[model samples]
Target: MSFRIVDLAETGSTNDWIADHPEDGLWVRADRQTAGRGRRARAWTSDIGNLFTSTFAAPQPGEGAAPQLSFVAANALLDTVARWVPRERLSLKWPNDLMLDGMKVAGILLEGHARGVIIGVGVNLAHFPEGTERPATSLAAAGIAPPSAREACGTLAEAFAAHRRRWREDGFAATRADWLAAAAGIGKPIVARLGNADLTGTFEGLAEDGALLLRLPDGALRPIHAGEVFTLGDQA
Candidate 1:
């Protein structure tokens, strides 16, 4: 499907703007966001040099579950980033974050609306927020000059289209395999913060349906569908 790209010099949030203007195959991008946000409504630092964009796309007939798109978006974003950085240095974090050399370099936020699902992506191309919950890094800091926000949006649109097709044709099994192969912290000790409660366990592989399979100390397994996950020893 062809995408309608809307580039704004500044906005409150690309995701919010997309939400207001819901249309399938519409891509909203902003040079800077005054009120950008991530999952859980956490404020995202929207500097001028980074990439802030969101796109609207219909879910496959049988594959509209929210979490599924997170994986698809992760795969797409990872694929786009791989073009500029070494694949070995990039990894997919559970739920919807991208890691570069063990630090967060990009994040994905999925929201469902009447028109379609909004896939909000924020990539640290030229700058990353400091003193954040997790360590953040930018592509420029890693010695790579990323494409402009507009250019990156075009690349992301193409990549997302391809991955979306792959998911539709092969189902979650295919996306799951690809996501796991690039997953970080698998089989490692980690902490999952669910509201006021925090659960510590080994980061088992993802369930077939996309839930996080966390193996606790008592030899029991817990399927986490939502929460903030932090690898052991990583400052949260």
Candidate 2:
């Protein structure tokens, strides 16, 4: 399906734009976002030269749950970035982050809207935020020339559509498999901050339904549906 893409010089947030517009197959990409944010409502550094875009995903019957779209988006973003950067330098972090060389390079946010789900994506093209909780990197930082925001959005839109189709046709089984293959930190020790508590365990993989599979010290596998994940670097 063709997307009605709106390229803006600036916006408060692409996700919020889609939230208000709610048009199926509509996409909003901004050169700069005045109020961009990631999961848990953390402020996102939306400077020019980065890719800030959001697209609406109309509800589809028999498709995986809305939250599972996070993986779909992650796969798409991974493909998009790999177009410019070496694939081996990239990996998808649990929940909604794309890691480049163990530092965050991209983030995905799926927000439920009245019409469907709004998949917001932010990629560090030429710049990344400094003094953040976790280390961040960008395409330029890795010594690769970054794509223009518009160009990156075009690639992302195509990748997202393709991945979404796979999710609808092949089901979450295939999508889950693809995500796991490129997932970061599998079998590595990490910490998950769960609001009132923090759990440190080995990153096993993802559960059948997209929950994180964390192996506790006792060897019991725990399914984490929601929480902020901190890699060993972040803990250090």
Q: TM per model?
A: 0.96, 0.97
- On residues 19-72, what C-alpha lDDT tens digit does candidate 1 reach at each position? 988887789999999999999899999999899999887755656465688999
The residue pairs in collision within model 1 are: none
Instruction: Quote model 1's TM-score.
Output: 0.96
What TM-score, to 2 decimals, does candidate 2 have? Answer: 0.97
- Model 1: how far residue 118 lies from native, Å: 1.2
- lDDT by residue (14-119, candidate 2, tens digit) is 9998899888778999988999999989999998999999999888876888888999999999999999988999999889999999899999988888778999
In candidate 1 the C-alpha lDDT for residue 68 amounts to 88
Off by over 4 Å in 2: none
For model 1, the run of ten residues with the poorest summed lDDT: 58-67
Q: The CA-based lDDT of model 2 is what?
A: 0.91
Highest-lDDT candidate: 2
